[model samples]
Structures are given as structure tokens and as C-alpha cells.
Target: MSPLLTVEELLALRSSGSPRLLDVRWKLGGPPGPDEFRAGHIPGAVYVDLDAQLASPGSSEAGRHPLPTAAAFQQSARSWGLNSSDTVVVYDDNGLLAAARLWWLLRWAGFDGEVRLLDGGLQAWKEAGQPLATGDEPAPAEGDVTLGEGKLPTVEVDEVPEFVENGGLLLDARPAGRFSGEVASIDPRPGHIPGAVSAPATGNLGDNGRFAAPDVLRRKFGDLGVSDDRAVGVYCGSGVTAAHDLLALAVAGFDADRVPLYPGSYSQWASRPDTPVATGPTEPPLIDAAEARRRVAEGAVLLDTRSPGGREKTGPIEGAIIVDRDNLDAEFDFGSAERHAEVASLQTPIVVICGSVNGSGPVAQNLIGRGFVNVAHVEGGAPAWHELDR
Candidate 1:
């Protein structure tokens, strides 16, 4: 069990030059750069932009935040002085939300050294009356960390069904409301992966924007059915916020398998008709017999769009695979898989849906723009699950 360093321990490390700090700050739907860090930051800390470091620079094929090539990401990390010997503390002013982006990056880059988050980030550190620095920062002394090769073990939209059937854990880090599909917010899809555990990123922080104690986090995660050692997979709207939960799980001192962050997540899953989804806030929608039959016969897949709790009661149509809307078109088979450069002679058929009739419609619109043909949707979603009967 790795123990979360106390504030005092961190203070000593900073004073003793044990850790190198990296401040990661980002705004939703903004261009990629480090304007925030240029204004002011922790002394000696470099900046890691969420968009640049975490996301790949493409939209058509790779989903947003497609895991960067390990070598390139490693070069970025090394340029910032993130090494195996020095403790790397990443922080952001917006609570743990943004700093978590870098914390997860360290793990992905295979820096198995002292990696921790500055509790409350810049705000809490300032509120606690810690020191501050400003102006263009300098890079680290040496740079040499190999970015290992191999798939980071990400499960596909179709794999969640078996994980749930086998009783593995699926965690969602979106806010509770969006998790319930009550508010879709940014993504076109309305719900979550069926049978996913809804543990909002907010739950891991106190009002101060800092992380809770290790014991508190341990108990909280334990209550949510996450064991110290489990095959845990996590996701957010588009693979962003979920990193916060992964960091907190790391902080809780739980021995666990290498957790995979689902990159496309809700945004990609919601877009395609072939992907299955669910709705509402009760049933744990999953790939059971009923959903499979509906999908096979109806030509639609189960789309789990509600929060995990909602899907608990509804379950999912059998063979109904999960898909999110944001990054789906990039990953979908939009007839482009075939070598037909003749500009899609016949229309590719699809059904747009979220957790309801309202959910899957707009997704259909995005698909239409992307050259999809015959786009339709599942009727009534979760609210009218019975509509599938007839």
C-alpha cells in the first residue's frame, strides 16, 4: 500500500529538493497553450497543457485526447524535469480537476517515482499561505525516461458487457447530474456505460479544492465496491475528468492493477447507431438477452447514456454495445472502412440516440454531417423502454 504523503512531508520534500512540481491548467473548449502558467506558478515548476500533453493533434481518426505516442509524451515530460528520481507534484488552481491531467500522464509515461498532487492546487496552496513564483520557467537538468510500448489496456465500447457480466468494475467520473443523463451538458449522448459505477470527481475533494485524506478516500472507494486490487477501468465525457478519479484512487494507497482510461468515453459512444446505450437514473443497463434480441431484430444497439445508477434498474438490450457521441464518428465504420472513394453511392444507415428519444436525435445530426446514411434512433429510450416490446 503506497501512502499518500502528508502536507508536511510534501513541504519537506519541496524544501529539500525531493520533488519537481508541474502545474497543469486548462479550460474547457479552449485552444491549447499555457497562458495560465505564464502569469504565475509554483517556483521551479513547468507547465503541462491538458490539451497538448494529454491529447493527440488530430480529430478524424483518433478520438480527442488520443493517447500521445509514448516517445513524444516522454520528451515533453523530460523537458519539464519529470524524472524517476525526483518527486513530481502536479497541481492546478481549479481544484484537483486539472492537475489530475498531469498525474495520470506520469503513470502513462511510466515514471514510477514519487508522483503526488498539490492538495487544493494553487488555490489551496495560496490559501494556506504557501509561496508563489512567476515568469518564464526553466526546464529540468537531465531528460531520460523511456516511454514503454504496449497497449495501455483500454477496453472497447463493446467490452463493457463482458466486464459487467464477469463483475468487473466500471467507474464514471462525470458529475452526478450528467451521470444520471438529466443534463447531457457537452456530449450528445445522455447516459453512461451500462453497469458503470458513478463516483463523481467532486466526491474526492473537499470544498478547498484539495484531495481528502488517504483513509477517507480509501473508505469512500471501498464503499463503492472498488477493492484495493481490482481490474478497474475509468472514463469521463471524453477521457478528461476521469483522470482525477484515477489520481485519487492512486492517493488512497490501494494496490491495484494498471488501470486503463477509456479515451473516447461517453462522447464517442453516443454518436453511432450500432453502439448500444441506456437512459434514466435507475437501472444498470447491460448487455443481457433482452437487449441483444432488440438490437439483433431492431437493427439498433443499446446505448447506455444515463448515469450508472440509472442503468442499474433498466439494464441494457443484449448485444447492445456502448458508444459515446463526441468521438464516435472518428472511430466509427462510417462506410469509410471500405475502399469506396466513389463518394458513398448508397447511404450508410444509422440510429442516433442517447438515453431517450430526445437523446439519440441530435447525435443523428452530427452523423449526417459526417456522411452517414439512413440515420434513425431507438424509440422512447429508457423512459419508454416498453416501446421496444412492440
Candidate 2:
């Protein structure tokens, strides 16, 4: 059976009153999910607090949102009026990013009955012209559902290296910016696990905000090298959004038992100084200014990644090709019609430089992520280059 249910299917199921609805409306930094649930939520749906009920107290060792203990989760499930044989549907406003957590948690806890995500989530319900309830629903009767543990596979922090070493695909389900180390708000560091692929959970959804058809998702994962022959694992900022990828993999025809979650994810990984973290698409080699100059002299493309004004202040290198630091993806889109001719080929020997090593390192890595092979960055960018001349 599918892991997702359409709004129409949910509505029909409601008539039977056998499926329990869970509204897991949450945002990273929120105005509070309960507040939103109080404003309006699906009729007969109970609000599930992602932080309070779904997770245990977190620390640097665990993630920002570690999984709740099975006993604790059972208590929470009982409070939600979950019966032993009840079908469950979970939804949230932001494309199942939050809701999939509940769906995954239930399955992981060995839920014998079916558990599914409401495709497109609350937005789809509203779009279908469904009526919503305001304020709060009455407290539900305590349920007698018995929960178990280890129904789903998981990867411990120590196992990550071996998993990747054994050719298992570890997918980082965070946004591309976070995966690239361009923007990191919560984690101890930016970037991703050394060998993890940047498979943002958002990509599972189409323009309509619903998950793409199974065949489409299959093609997407196939392109990412997700074959039946290899094991696949997923992780996110904490572990919540990672489930979104797990669900997508299931929908894409991958065996649910084969895909595992790295519950500690980036938050825990980054916290450990001993573990290696990769920034950008690849951690490009850093070349000295003299080496950069020599490479440039040997017909290598010198990609000056600085703002127009920053370049003006530094005095541009004679042969450097200026690229806007903020728009590297667009500037280096080799497949696009407007692709930069100098670095169009994946084999192009490109040397990147910015104001300093801090600036140029990520740019070189970004380029590598964009499929460039022979790429490096100036160790200290313009300042180091100027020192070479002096």
C-alpha cells in the first residue's frame, strides 16, 4: 500500500471514522504549532507538538530533535487516541516536512496498522475546499495501543563512515544552501557529511507542492544513483526532515526496510570535532597565489568570485573572469543556454579566488558540486595574490 493518502481518500476514510488524524503543523523557528492549530485545523484532527511530544531533550551529542523513547512515544500516542488497529494520517502546512516525522515515527515504533502522510498536507485540504475546525477539539479517550522498538533500521554515528565506505548512499535531505555551507543557522557547522549526496527533501515535491508521481520519483533517485543493488541512508539538520526522504524513497519503489535514518544527522555530526565535514559540492584544493598565477598563465580559467564593487576596490587581475559570488549557480550553469563559455566543460581547469580563503573556498566547492573536475581556489584570494607581487 502507498505511504501517502490524497485529500479525497482522507475525506472518504473519515466517514468510516477508523483513521486517526494528526496535525503536525510546525516550522523551524515558529509562532508555535499549537497556535496555528487553534486558528484552524482539519476536523477531528489532534495537534501534535513536534518538540514537546515527538522528541527527547537534545544536546550536542544527540541532534536538535532526537527521537523520543518508545515508552514516551507510546504515552503520547495514547494521548492522541491512537488505537491498536487504527489507520493514521499525518499532515502539516509545509509539504509534509513536519508531518512525515510522525508517519515515520509511528512506523518505526512498530505500528501494526497503516500509517500514511496526507499528500500536499494541510494546504491540499484547504485547496480542496474542505471545512476546518477552530479552537481545540475535546480531549480524546486514552488508547491501549502497545508500542515496540527497532521496527525500522537506523545508522549510529559510529557506523556512518563504514556505511559510506561500503558504497551505501547517504543522502543529506537539507536545503541546498545548508548542504553547500552557504547558510547554516542552527547546526554547529555548515556543509554535509563527507560522502553524503545533496538530496534536498523539497525536491520530492513537484510545482503543485505534492510529491511527484512514483515513476518521476524513481527517475529522480535513479539519476542520483539509488539502485536496488545499493543500500540508501538519509539524514537532515536533525532527523525529522530525513524521514521525508525515506518516504520519498519508499514512494520511488525502494524497499522501506533497506533505507535507514541517521537520527543524529548533521547536528550531531557537526558537533563532533573528530568527524570530517565537507563544505560546498566538494572541498576543492587550495592553491597558493603563485600556483594560481601559474595555472592562469597555463590557460586555466581564473574565476574571480567577488561582488562588482569588491572587485573595483581590489583592482581586477588582468586575465581573471569575474563571476558574482552570490550567483555562482546561474553563472556556472553549464547545461543552460546562458552558460559561461570559459568553464562550460566539466574538464575545464578553473581556479577560483575571492577576498580571502574564507570566500573562495566555498566557491570552488560550489563549482565542484556543479560538476567541474579540475578545480581549485587561491589559498588567500586577492590579498595573498597582492602579497605575491609585493
Candidate 3:
């Protein structure tokens, strides 16, 4: 079954009410998901608390977002009105990042019915001019779905070393910074599993915040060494966003059943002192302000990702190419007639700078994922560059 449902497909499905709709909106920090759901949601969509319904109480051993027991998940599914043979559609505001968890869990729990993510998620729905319903959905009829465990393959914490040793490609789905030990926000330690390749899940998305085309994803994974003959595994800070990578793989025509998930992920691995954590990208992808200036002087394209107001406030760098940071993919799409000619070649030396590293880092990683051969971000972004000049 296809892993995603377009908004038009969902609109047709909604009229029939044949599928169970789950709003699994969540973010790492900030306004609560339930609050957002209550404010406005797809009609008949039940809110699913990622923390309460989707995950078990976490420990250092199980990781931050450990899978719930089968019985627990079955109960939660029932509450959401899942039926034995009903189709299920899940969505979130943040692309499919949060919703894919529920889709993977449903498959993992042995749901025989089709389960798919709403492509591009809530934003897509809204952008299509679809109407949203406010307030809690009416309580659904208790469902009779029976769930079984181990429907999907998984790698336990102890099996990580052996898996990597035996030639399996273990992909780290966290942002590049976290994988490189440059930043460790929630994990017990920085760096990644010894032998894991950095493949941030966000890189799976196009500029529209939807999963990239299957061919694009196939090339992306192929670039990272994924192939039919090789075994592959994926993990993130916890187990959650890693599923996003798995979903992208499925969309890219890989067998979803064959690839395994490391449920404990880095959180569990890092908590154990016995585990080895490796840091640094194979090549340094971050450049200092001076290096960025030098590269720009030598004809490298400097991408200024600051917003219009921000650029006005900070004063634009004379020769920088200003593109909408949120829409970088469109700007860099070489196949499009609208593609930027200045950095049209994949081999072009591209330096990205934003207000700070927080904005620039992911953009740099994203470009690299999109097959750009030479990409880097200013370590401290525009402010740092200006400070260095001073």
C-alpha cells in the first residue's frame, strides 16, 4: 500500500467516513498538541497524544519515546475508533514527522488494514483550501481491533554493534549537528552509534514540507549507500522521527518489512557508558566567517537565508544570493526553469548563512542531502560573520 494520501484523496475518503482519522500533531517543545487540535482539526479527526497514547513511560534504558506495550497501544487504537479492517489516516502539522509514528506503530501492532500518512499533513490540507472543524470530535464507538506484536522488525540496543559489524547500513535520522556532537539537546550524550551514517529525516522532505518524489528519495538513499542487497536500519534521538525515514524509504520503493527500526535509538545507546559514540562529519560541513568570506570572494555563492525584514535589519551582504530559506528546494531545483543560475551546478560551492547556526545548519545539511557536492554553513551565521569583520 502507498504510504501517503494526498489531500484530494483524503477529501474523497472523508465523505465516505471509511477511514479512522488521527491527528497526531506534536512538537519537541511548545504549545501542546491537544490544544492545537482543539482549536481546529480535520472533521471527525480524533486527537492522539503522542506522549500519552503513543509512548510508554520512558527510562534511560528504553529511551525517551519507547514503544508502548501491545496491549496499551491496542487500547489507544480502540479509543481512536480503529476497526479490524478499517483504513487509517494519520496527520500532523509538521509535515509527516509526528504522524508517521502512529502509521508505523499501527503496522507494527499487526493492523491488517491499510495505514497511510496524510501527505504534507495539516498544512497541505489548509493550503488546498479545505475547511477545518473546531473542538473535540464526538467520542467514537469502541473498536474491535485486535493487535499482535512483532509485525515489524526491530533491533534491540544490544544488537546494534553486531548489526553494524555485519554490513548493515545504520542510518542516523537526527539533524547533522546532533549526529556530529556539535549539539546534544535531549540525548544523554552527543555523537552517534559507531558506524552510523548521518541521514537526517528532515532531508526526506521537499520545500513544500512533503516527502520528496520517490525518484529523488531513491537517489538520496542510494547516495547514502542503500541498495536492495544491503540491510538497513534507522534511528533518531529516540525512536520517533526515525520512522519518518522508514516511511520515506517505503515511498522510495524499498520493502518496508525488510528494513528494521532501532527502537531504543540514540537515547538508549547514549545512556549506556559501554556504547561507543562517534562524532564529526566525514568532511567538515561548517565553515567559519573568514572561510565563508574567502569562498564568496573566489566565486562561491553565498545564500543569505534571512527573511526580508531580517535582511533589512541586519543589512544585506553585498554579493550574497538571497532566497527564501523556507523555500530553498524550489530555488535550487535545477530541473525547474525557475532554478537559480548562479548556483545551478551540483558542484557549486554553496555557503548558507542565517541569523544563527540554528537556521543555517539544517539548510546546509539539506542541500548536501539533495546531492549538492559542496555545501557548508557559517558556524555562527550572519552575526558571527559581521563580528569577525569587526
Candidate 4:
């Protein structure tokens, strides 16, 4: 909970060289990283790839984009010249939302140093006639601080349902439509967990794309029934958008009781029939697994939910798109209402797949929520698909 840094405040730090900037955006399908930075980026800013720099390799236990190990994080900080003594400001494409997550990660890693989100993000910065450097950039100096295991709070999926049953406030960072089960999603199942409340993360953003003011966010959290001490869990399709809320909460002084992130989220929750889920205005969408898989392979697109590393390690389906569990917003932007309408060239059915059945299920359902119409989940994930093919 360092103080909020306005856009101007951050810019002043830039001029004084007191605050170092990190550009954290990447093209999902193209290049190893820093494509945007190479095109042009904030002067003297280092590049932090969301896929490589900020997250741990995906595991069955952690859906995707799990926090980097403390040592790895420390390594990254030092590589970027992020000493514990200086203020660090992060910016991303306004809509990408990776900027905010970077801020949260710093605090989670135990750096009490000042971390701020740039208002309007990089897009706004460019629009304001700010300068951006292109081609090559100068390398950053190594930082002096040693990275340590920082204390950050989080919870697992199995842990949250009980917390919910025990009166834990479940804040879903997706939209109301998706949460209420009014529509279907790309997963095989379409609906949310048993009794979760919707608090779409977008509410945390303002007209300018930066996070809302602390006071404004405090009230928003209040409306969602988040209390200072109430045990709470925030989730999105697969833990990415939800981080937006976690960051918002942090910014709003909920630091003393930072809410935990249910990494798998609805994406994981709805896959297993064992997990209690509500669908259809009161019921969670249910479908036969064999049939779901059959339909998916026949004509559907597979949406991969594992982290970027997970995809690389496990290998993706023959034609599946790489949509990290924590990156639904960007995924939506790349393949949603706007993108899909125009990319009519690819006329194939769509499917959602993750490392486990759990992550794919809800994402499938979420696509249905967005009126995707045709979707399903690969029964076991990469392993299943390979074994089945063999």
C-alpha cells in the first residue's frame, strides 16, 4: 500500500530519474517479447514480459500465471534495476491491464517500495503527445537490493467453496452476465460456482483506463460486500482479471487484509461435476463429457487456459489458441465481439482447453456467456488429447 501515484506524479519521477519505468506488454502470438517496446516505448524503460518475467511455470496445482518463485522474482527485480529503495511505475496498453498486475506482484513479493500504475497507461501517454523511443534502447543497470520471499496472501479453489459456505464473500471479477449464468461460454460447462457475487474487474477502471481512485474503489468494494476482515476470495475465468480487483483492493488500503486470489476461478470450478455450481438463472450449465469432447474436436476452437509457460511445456492442441488463464481480457479483445466478427475467415468450431478439466469448463461456459454459440472442452487437456490421438 504505497501512496497512489497520479500520471503527472509518475512523469515527474521520470524526469528526475527517481522512478524507473517498466513496459510490460507482449504480442501473444508473435515474438519472444518486447515487440511493443521495440516498436516504441517509454524512454529508458526496461521490458518485463508478462509471460516470462512475472509468472512461474504452470503446474496442475496452479492453473496459469502463478507467481514467480521468490528467488526468480528477485532475479527479475535486480535485472531491471528495481532496488528496494526506489519508486517503480508500470504501464501497459490501457486495455491489456497487465500494468496493474505488475504493481500487485511487486507488493506481493515484499517490496514495501513505492509501486504505482500509470494513469491512462501507455496508450494515454502516447495520446498526450508524450515521447516514445523506437528501434534499440539502453539497457538498465542492475539493482542493489536482494530479492526475498515477500509476503502476499492467496487461497486455492477447493479452499474458497468452503469459505463461501462458511459465509466468505465471493467476489467474481467477471461481468454480471457471465456471473449470473444468463449466457454461455466457450467451456463445456456454462455457469459459475455455487453462490458467488459478481464484481466485474472493469469497474475498477475509469474513463481514463487507469485504476479508479482509492475512495471510489473503497465504495465499490463495499457494494460487493468486501469487509476489512471478512474472509474473501476474488476470481476471474482463470485468475488474471481478478488480479485487477486484488490490485484495486490493495490501492484502496485493504493491504492489512488483502484478499486472496482463487487462481483457477470459475474456469476450474465448473469443470468437475463434483463441484457444486449453479446454472440457468438458478442452474449451472451441464453437458456430457464424451459428447462435449466429440463436439469440440469436430468443429470447435480450443481455448488454452494454462499459463504461457504451461502451453510451451505441455504443448497445445493442434489448432488451439493460446489464451492464458489469467489473460482472458486480452483474449477477449483478440477473439471476442470485435475480433471474431471480422476474423470470419476461419470457419471452425471453437473449444476451450486447460491443463485440467476445471479450467476449461468455466471458460467454455464463459464463452457461452458471451453468446459464442458453439463451444466445448477437451476432456482431460493436453495429456488427454495426446493419449486419445495415440
Clashes of each: 53, 0, 0, 29
Query: Global lDDT for candidate 1?
Result: 0.63
Q: Report the lDDT tens digits of candidate 4 across residue range 1-390.
A: 443465567777767877878888743345545666788888878888777778777544455566678888889888898887888888777444566667767877778677777766777778778888886676678897665544667777768767888988877776656776675564446667777766667667764666667876785576456788788888877666777778777777785336777766776676555777666421123334454466565444556677777778877666556666565555555456534332132222466677777877778666545534334566666676666556
Query: Among all windows of ten consecutive residues in candidate 3, which has the lowest summed lDDT?
Result: 279-288
Residue runs of model 3 more than 4 Å from their true location after superposition: 282-390
Q: Deviation in angstroms for 350 in model 2?
A: 22
Residue 54 of model 3, lDDT score: 89
Residue 329's C-alpha lDDT in candidate 4?
Answer: 56
Once fitted onto the true fold, the runs of candidate 2 whose alpha carbons sit more than 4 angstroms away are 282-390
Best by TM-score: 3
Over the stretch 1-390, how does candidate 1's per-residue lDDT look in tens digits?
342344566689877875777778886765433776777777777788777776777352344666677877877777776666767777777766877766666666667776777676777666667677777776667666656534345766677677777878888887655766766456656776777767777767754556767876775576467885667888887777888888788788764337777777777666655666665442222233344344446443333445455566666544444555555544454454632232232122233334665556566544433433234455566545545565
Task: Order the candidates by lDDT, highest first.
Answer: 3, 2, 4, 1
Off by over 4 Å in 1: 1-7, 30-33, 58-61, 139-142, 149-152, 228-231, 282-390
Per-residue lDDT for 60 in model 2? 97
Off by over 4 Å in 4: 1-3, 26-33, 177-188, 213-215, 253-257, 267-273, 280-390
Model 3 reaches what TM-score against the true structure? 0.76
Candidates 2 and 3 compared: the better one by TM-score is: 3
